[model samples]
Target: MAPSSPPLPQFEEAKSTTSTVLWQLYHHRPRSPRAIALSVLTFFVLLYMLNTSSSQSEPNFWTKFPSQHPFPERPEDAQVALPQRNDITINDTLPHDLEKPNPQLHILLPAQRSSRGSCRTITSAMILGYPPPTLIGYGHEAHGTTDFEQMVGRMKRTLAYLEHSRTVKDRDIVLLVDSEDVFFQLPPQVLVTRFQNILRKNNKDLLRKYGVTTVNRPGPKTAPAVVQKYTQRVLFGASKKCHGAHATDPGCVSIPESSLPPDVYGWKTDIHPDGFLNRPRWLNPGTVIGQAADLRLIFKEALRIIEQRQKKNGDEEAFTQIYGRQEVVRELERRRTVSLFKEWGYKLLGISDATNISTINIRLETEHRYEYGIGVDFESELFFNQLLSADDVEWLKYSNVTKTSALQGSMGVPREHRLLLPTDVAALPNPFNYSLLALNQTTLPLWNKTLDKLPNPEDHTWNDIPLMTNAHSASVPVLAHVNGNTKLRNTWWEKMWFFPWARALLRRYVRASQGFDAAQSSLLGGADWWDMRGGRGGVWTDHESWVRFADVCQGQERDLFDDDLGPWGKENGDPDEPVYNEWGNLVYGKEPPQLPQPPQLNDINDHW
Candidate 1:
């Protein structure tokens, strides 16, 4: 047997193969049972460590900030890690890029309004006004007085901050809106998606004019997701009607008419009236959205125009005069004409027309709620037409021709004060009298069902928001802008606590922050008062659900109507102290001891 084995194994190939196998095993792996087990254990241990490392799995900054202040959720939370400056930036703590841009969709708000009382209430209203406030919190707030930075300056500064932000990529869309008076009901993603749909349904031919040789190159992309991917650089909110024959269609939106000359909207304000332009299309400074780099170009050009022409015309109106000129130049590019804003350092990356944006809606009101009372300063003539349609709320929003403090419609509210509130609340009040607003027709809603699935549904927060829609389509509105006085008491929205859908959203907010007690003093946050940090604050992100189980406002020792920390003290004792009225409602003072003056001291009759 030994002689036969030796003859078989003597072959050179067999000998070499055995030697190679033994060499590899000896050098690359342990052959012992204990050593092999230990090697397997060591491999698993390293992998476990890597999987749990801070880089792989991290906590939500939304809930992390309150427990630990000042520090970021991660070292790289701020894109560039620049030191914060309160005087120049939004706050002394947050960096320009506090959030990571998964893809794109940047919301920017400029609040130069006074950081005062009812403004705080209105601000809170705007924040809570969104069906799910969570869809919004990731926006920006541009602060400081407007006196130093005119409208143009404010917009430019904010654009500059965004342009340089790490969160912004070349393709990201930057949407500029007035935070004070505006309520965002849909996710920013939906806004962009709708904007794209409007273009496909209306601006296809218009892009051809801008040298898009292919014009929807791949041809027909009807899917919402597909259209959103190809949307243009700029999308302006429609202030004037763009459709002639197809105005009321549900899915098709008529953007600013493509048949008209480029000189009809935005910066091109010089064309003679009449024709398509006769109707006067405008890019209301109210909202403007575009690519980050493109937006930077816009703001930069606007600032240069302001610096060049500030002496000729006030800095405030300069931006309005030159707002849409970039569109004009793009038109010139289409026509192969000379450019004014300079085509250098800029590429025509999908710059396009004003599209009528779509929003979402939920029909909740069934009984048609109404209010009327004596000496009630919070009077609202807010009534909706077409009672069964969800668009009734939109009729209320688009119908308003009255301006908020943004345009100086009130006595003491310096438009900036309405914009400057510490919590960005100043930007939400509509100084324009709600009673005088010219309510409009129904605007389309969006596709997102964010409001459909209520948050913390197991709890009682449903009072704040209820089942608004059984079928959410284009006919409803997702947000409501309460442009009236809510400071004296929870005015317009307070009663919605029992609205057909959900009312607890606002009432719960007041109860949580003791906003009712603080209502007498929300403008000036008191010693124990918590600042929402302008809707972006920790209170909303961390404790909004606290109202479900606990009376969050219980321990606070805030005094109602305290002058130093109050909106108005007992000065002149005319407006009475915060007192319960005949209907068990809180009021400014009882009937004035002195005969009520006609205007300022006038008595109001509002019924609920």
Candidate 2:
């Protein structure tokens, strides 16, 4: 048959093709089992490497895990009305049915007598329409011989006021500052809004850092997983230098890094001979803000540390130690919940450990004891601690949309300093304005024609500029703590926007009844913090007694008042006098005038 096919060309070609196929099949024996397995393993290894590298680059990846703890609740949310943008207008006369707002703001300035600087703090707060501060340790001289002793006295008195006072509720906001150093820059509205906003932002970061999130539960419900909850409720001013501790102590070395950019201080960052280039990571007791309840806890813990140590240590040391320990505990909890493989991944990625906190030893009680929700204003969003950071700030006006960019650039302001758009800045309403015509819809002017045109020629328009801003952090700090170069206090105080018309502004603030902006209050989760009674200038003492604002500020007129702007009282009033009331009453008698009791809330909407 082959010989017959050879005679046919088609048959011979088919035979040749079959032979070639058989030869290829024989030579190409199934790849060796070992080689195939090795190849597959290499492919998987490459894929995993790629996946891990990608995740490492993403900041949030491997940082999120479901939290096991419950979300904290605010009781004020139920009592305060949700703010609407147009719910209320700035009015000269408050409604008769107005009631005390929920979670009222309480300022605490502890001092023996109001100094020029302390008086400036009081005057600024008043001008900005803040509630009368409760003066802790006022009229008490000779606190202690040492600086530590003085700090302890202040903390003790502050804690006592928060713990025993009836007027200050647990939820009420309390701002405590160094009586002679700190000064308010922004209004209470901005302070409250920024505070809540900062807390929210910080808490979000804390949650991520702790690798905690919320996830779905068994059914339609959702719940936090087996993880710890980390949040920041109490914020303290941040400083570049650590006080009351040695360079290598946990207080100095164990604090978390500041959230500010690495180059916030330019080329000298962390390398300056004076330590001015370092980040603001240390806790500053000079200025702090928190709820009354949280404040009480932190103060109590600090005082306990001071008493237990029996050393010359102060509240600053105690606070620093506390913060260090809190971070350590948080890191321990974070690692405990995270997977071992993730830990290895983190090590490979060069992410530094939380802190060299193992050197710090403290009794780890319930999480609540260590976790006072203590956090620092690293960005100076709420408070600026001017220690080594004196040169980081400048005064620039953003209300002028056309000039803002040029001003920032010419002034050497960092790009981060212009975070707020010119339109946003220009559109900001003057919180101090309290007329029917002063609706929230009306934006502040770049020049303030009425104030700028005053007969007395001064370079500043109080309505035009905000106070000292930290260009490094892009923060318009609510208050400034002049902790460094004591002489700067006077110079910086003069730079304040309200320094020229403080007396007049203070009167305007007190004369208008305290009310809440629905939109702003809503930002604080419906907590009305502006609950001041109209027409008053009295400060509640740590002993629960009252003192006249005029009495405290009598000798401080030179620093707080602009005589050329006229007196704080009615037209043609004495320019040098301190007027405390609309009735022309110079001072009240032994018993202080009683604030009107809030109208009974027959219905929830009655006050509204």
Candidate 3:
């Protein structure tokens, strides 16, 4: 229409070029505003959803599972159970074969010796007189008996049970004696043999003077007046009387009711003293010369004492005047010293040299005089159990050493009442012999192999010496290797420089959970505010200053860099002036320098 455009470029040619250009524009053009906005909105929505879901999830996901699932509820309880018994098997007949044939066995329960009774004084004399295998006493009377009868009784029972279960012959019988109430623990056969030997060894004159035609029995006439004096002294002491003889000057020894300690007149102290004065002096009846007859002797002696006391007093109430059955039992307990009995048994058995064995006092109130045994290694606990069960004896089981009873509250029933044989001694792992050898011989070689592959050998220098030098060298790329392979990365330089440094920082964070100290230095990249000038490149400061400055700039990077470039970056006044050369050499040496440019308004106000 405007001169027909001269069909200027020929419509077809123009159209072809236009189509090619249009095709390029279609692929290369910037996206539309609406499309860009939609993409950004979608991304934001996805990010928000991810954050919300993560926050909503349970913190302890594993615990949320059903109880029927077999996952361990507690970390400590997950340890695998250890083997109960060892592979070594022992024959039961071995103990019998080792023992001599038909050796007579004897169980001796010494007469009860009470703190307040005649037996008590006798026991003290015997203990003071003899060496090993000395006489000890135990009785049935409460106040006149040993102090630790329950403990001694349990030990006797334990030994007897063991011997009987082992099918040991009567001749092989071991003498079991109580310390306070009885004197000797020798079996009848052993006692007879020993007595014969003694008689042979003693001179005729000595035998006539000391030996008796018949075993002399102590009675009222034999009882020394000194014993009564001592008894009165004890009574006075218990009553807190600092002066006077108790029986000779009764009023002098008697304290006013208000002055007496609480329960001074109770059966425990006063009544027992009175019983000692009233009861007829009798011979130690539990003293017997027979095998397997200790308990029987004790019972007989107790009955004899009770009967004698009743007859001597000639009153129907004579028995009540001294003590009831409970008091008799207590008297027996007072004289019984289980430790002494155990020591005597050990001396007699010839098994005292074993280093790992220890005989402890086990108090069993339910049983009569029988109480001590060896503590075995924990590894032998099951074996001990097997032996005991086969022997027809009950084992006392305790939850722990501190508890008084075997069973626990609401947990479950205990196994049984038995002595504990801890295998902890035998099963203990030897760290010096085993664990050290493994670490030095095996693990160290593996670690060395990995170190050999590092690209930079200088980095290994830190591994061989102090860590600080290594950390300094590692800060420079040229001096230290940053290998991609983790095994290679674990070289000495990496470990000493990075790992320890990182670990220290992690520890700080962990400790922060408890409490934190603000004065500690940062472990991240070095500081920027402290004017550190000797770091990796000439661009940064020295290690110490950089570390310090980095700590100051802990959360504010932009502010730190801005401050450095502003007032902190200047020489005297203006930053544009070059006071020194690029090599850090002063251009004017000692001379004062002149400013190269006028101070800008921004430099004066904005920098400040």
Candidate 4:
């Protein structure tokens, strides 16, 4: 019909175009039916080939597994093995004989408190430690105490310990005194070497040449002068008896009475018994020397004198009088006899008329009052002041101030100040002026009451704490000095009590906090949270922590931070954030978190 209306030409053309486009789109867009079918067939072939290769490479499970069989046994052969020992003996005598000579000097100190002042006298012909004639102190104790026996005992123990530890030999003996005033600061080793050289040649000759002095002149008489000369000769070793060869042998040689020379006996001169040349106030007991054989004789004679004194007086009286004037005189006599021993010949020296060795006059005066024992003055304050100067004082003050504000702080006060004003300034005992109004009134028991109130073992943690330990586990010696007057009591308390307590407190605090470990805290970022939390809560906190906490509590950190990091992070904007936090915690977060806002500039301005 009209060629089917020409199939509505536009519609028919549109339909045909749509069908062709659909067919092309279907064919180009992924896989069509033919492609999919080929893909499936290819996948199947690949899988089959893979399965076949695997089967070919792998062992069959149905086949029996191979078993490992034991090898044929071989005949055993027996053999004997015996233990052997090659004995060898070593002889100690050969090594002992080959030991090298020890040259370390052994100094023996035997201090005794005497009436003059604390003194140290050198006995070695060879000067050691410090030279003879060295003026070390004026008239004060080396240590505060004047108990000579106690000093000697301590010195003996110290020396014994030193000797054992240092491996010192027995022959190199040198005796020292604790008396600071007695030791002269000179080239001691030089003097010692000179003395040793002289002794090596002719000990008596050197002593006679060096020992002569104008003091202690002999009376102008034949027999007395002869005896005096003989005494001087024996004492100074101007005579031959001082030599080791004849020291023990009294029958070796004798000075004929007729042949005694005038100068040999005594020379007329003024006696200046003020300095070292004169007898010292205190003498070291160990300086007294005698031959091995003569030691027993001297001991016997000393015992005889002691016995005589005991017989005359009761036991207590005899004991008390042992170190008295009579005993001193007997000791002098016994010393003379000991001097006769060949071994002691070195002690005697020839008196020299040329050298005028001047003795130093020490004038010690206290502006406040005579406090403790006069001997204590040397080591207490007077001597220290003499030795120290204005520059030293200033240096010490600056050092202490600087140290106290440092990270570690100061360790108590300077040693000199501790020795001087030992007690607290507020606790200082009132100075007493001898009241003419109440001169006869019994002094109020102020000193005793004050001492009773003073700090003791029960008052501090270090009261019974031991400062040292030895092989025997003995505690370090504790000493105390009690004075008869107010001044003495004050000095003793200050030096012995207050200073030591202060030092102990500092030391104990330091030792206790030194081993603190900050890593034990279980916090994010492994922070030192104790510091951030104001250093409180646990018992494991250290001194630095407490100091930090105290500073923070006192609002010191605001002042510090205000000057250092400024006040930008005081409020808002994540105070724990790395950029904002002044104390350096980055990951700190509160459990119930709040939204963070930008920091306000006004906050910093307010701080300013």
Candidate 5:
């Protein structure tokens, strides 16, 4: 204690420093505990607000491809070994291998007699060089169908052909597709393999035992994988919900005109080739493939439903099973009724009997898990009205749902046969998974150059596969659906303003196709649709069909035949006169998008 004093130098130094710190803290504006807590909370709140705003401003899938799964870039030098000049195809521009046929498969298309918009569909098949379709509903005037009667007409004829005719055996694949919109990306063998994979059956042994050319049935009681995976002999898929008039209230069976803009709801008049149609929530029957025997039953059921609906509704044509007529929906709207589905018909009182349906929905395929990306329908984000999330591409299938009490259960679709509503779209009721579109999200993977597991166009360069040189995994949607505002949304414009690549893609396909003058900048003019249809707009190649089919893909289906492109071929400020290199398009410009150096397509490699 004797001077614990006067302390040491180290002690003095520490004391001085401590004093300085205390002086600063004492002089500095000190806050209460509550004030400090509030300040900290405020900083966090500001940070959260900033994050929310930035996320909200991000562009949706409509404009940009998802970062996780971007579009695939085209292979620079993939060459295909296409056959020599053969059958005429789309744009009357493509050369097909019709002379050399794939005898193992039977591709069926119900075409009109040079009347269904310039025979572009048939020409597409011919250009692809697949064998001619059985040709159902030819020569007859198109009375028009509500739910794919053209296909139904062909199905009936095909079934008849299969029932008694010895030509179609169990081994033969019978593919029914939308003639014009879809292009044959690969050969029949490839398609058969895809079908077998979807079927999820052990048909390799049976296939090898019978040989690819000849198909024999397994012994009685032994079900074929074709019948198993392609259950009920049908295949299709569902797309995102379109925010048309019907979406005002998905749970409501009918929406009134008052709930929608005139252009947003069902058209008051029959503006399309087929009138009074009811679109299914799921199951776009654009392209369906199956064995002949099983396919016959699916067609038969569809026909029966059509007949029953026709008889009860008092319409000679227009065959839609579950989806009711425009009048029916309107009447419900007037009544302000709210139900999962609309009634069959006011004229007929009782609920219709349940019918059988064999659908192949890519949207719900358990095997693929419904991966996200564009298919034929490019407006999925718009339809869903939301941006992508981790769970966006969940597995959806018929086994997912339980019951359908209304005509959404038309023909009283059997509980087992009916497409079960996917949980994502079921808020609207009766949402099934049907993506049978030509370029569905599932099917497009075959052409996606981005996926490592799938075969790249470059790997098979100078091989047999018909390479879609213009195919951009991220840029180009598989189906390239001709969709957009079209006077419905603020984004609608005079130009096509749809799947931007539609015209280029179709034109590229025609160029990539064999036989047509590969060198001709603008060989000739197409007869219908947008520009390709000889009217106005920038449609080229078989894009005429692309625009034509857009109407059918509508939500409420306001108009199935709408033409805003002035007069076809005139919308682009060109007089109906065909001119090459107009600006820079292959048709308008002198040079193509740098000759997509894809070689002649032969057959694909053993790679998936």
Candidate 6:
């Protein structure tokens, strides 16, 4: 009651007096310009320190951002979505030419000599309905002293050729393989379909593991995180060992573990002396498949690294470093992003511990260049590296259920075969499981009925032509790299299903009509075996004109065909000639043309 009586004097006056006293205290004396400036400077310094502390680097003067900046400072700005399979619209970006149907496949084989191995490679590809290969470095002499140096030289020349080719486009899928050791077992259609499918599935898994996230852009409001994901755009054949780098190097130790099942190789996984049971986690440059642009970028960077380091064994090492650096930078970015979001109280986000630490010390200026979209074929689906895996594959007729059944409970069969047959061991009409491929499904239930429906269907049924299947992973690889043992090259080449009827197969492949059966095309996702170089399959030589298949492969009859095996139509009383085109023209009609003389070399060192 007493306080109320006093307040009646002036409630409003008391409030005004209190406000005036506070204002006077705040501005008892005029603030100096230096004091105001100092206060502002302190606030900004604290903000800069906060940002720089995350990257452990000084802010760049020009950009005012940390060197090797993993991601944008604002978490909201990191949202990135994976590109859809159908979203790739290369046709629109290419130079319009109605005359040319966009070629989807390009094969790159680098060989200095047309040896038995090289001839067999060319012959096998032709037999399997592949377009003519661009024989890179064919006319060049061996450059370096060591095998490694020669390998690097071949890589350099191949890079040069791809860069110069007008026919090759950014979107085209390119297959690069070791000329002498690699063999094409499947048709172009199977290779392309499997490639696209592998990439699709691998990318989908990656997106689920790394691409999804939520972040606050401006404030409390959240948005889907668009983090730049690591995709397996360019896939190289995987190896049991990281060939070129040291054991402790990031290339050898820091790569994401192989995606194969943990028990893929059983108890002897990494301990096997033969390395047959080891997981294929390392990169093998012998066989690579990727988009033209992606391959070009990787090779370009590899060449740069070679020149900078003057490395003799740089081919695989350079590639391994590139991949390792990519993983390292990606890991840094991932760690930075996680730390930033965690600071903002984000929890429950999944982070992978696949790679714990990286020994790679990537240069700050070149951090952006490490992203070459590199990956390895861990399952040996598209490319099989035979470095330490000589006994892993078998030539069995997948369509013949009896072949697998015969070995099921037999003691004479290898232990691996007796354990479990590969997933692709059985007949598979729908190999890819793609619904679109079922458009023109046929009555025959065998996989790749296209091969079965050849000229003499009975003479060369699906049972006759076997395919190479990887026993451990149950994969029918597109191609095989016979790298470890040179002695096995001829034996394995003979084991190929088409080897027995190479002449007949090559004839059938070359003379195939403009369009494949609609059913076959549907199975191949509209891909053709020979659509490159205007459908006249041949080798792109150093000469002005492209060399036809007959020119490069005519003389190597022994390498290309098995005389003892005879022809496919032998039961019908063999045709007049061993090889004849669909129009009854002799497959090897003319004398093989002389190869173009190699350009004069100033010196061995100068050529590379």
Best by TM-score: 2
- The local distance difference test score of each candidate is 0.32, 0.65, 0.25, 0.24, 0.31, 0.63
Where does model 4 exceed 4 Å of error? 1-100, 110-168, 201-267, 270-608
Compare candidates 3 and 5 on TM-score and give the better one.
5
* Tens digits of per-residue lDDT for model 3, 157-261: 433443343322322222333333221111122233332232233224222322212222359566332110000000000111112212222122111122122
Identify the candidate with maximal lDDT.
2
Per-residue C-alpha lDDT of model 5 across residues 119-237, encoded as one tens digit per residue: 33433333233443444444453675645555455556656766665545543456665443443323332344334443333233223222222123569876533211101123332
- Model 5, runs deviating above 4 Å: 1-103, 115-118, 142-155, 164-166, 183-189, 201-233, 241-281, 311-608
Least accurate stretch of 10 residues (summed lDDT) in model 2? 438-447
lDDT, candidate 2, residue 125?
Answer: 79
> What is the RMSD of candidate 4?
48.5
Q: In lDDT terms, how accurate is model 2?
A: 0.65
Per residue, candidate 1 scores C-alpha lDDT tens digits across 575-596 of 3344553576644344436765
Clashes of 1: 52
lDDT of 4 at 172: 30
lDDT of 2 at 183: 81
Candidate 4 lDDT tens digits, 447-477: 1231213244332322222211110101111
Error of 4 at 348 (Å): 26
Candidate 2 local Cα displacement, residue 92, angstroms: 15
lDDT of 6 by residue, 521-571 (tens): 322324443333444436775332477555565556656675643333232
Ranking by TM-score: 2, 6, 1, 5, 4, 3
Every candidate's CA RMSD = 27.9, 14.7, 50.1, 48.5, 27.4, 18.3
Steric collisions counted per model: 52, 3, 87, 28, 52, 5
Q: Sort the candidates on lDDT, descending order.
A: 2, 6, 1, 5, 3, 4
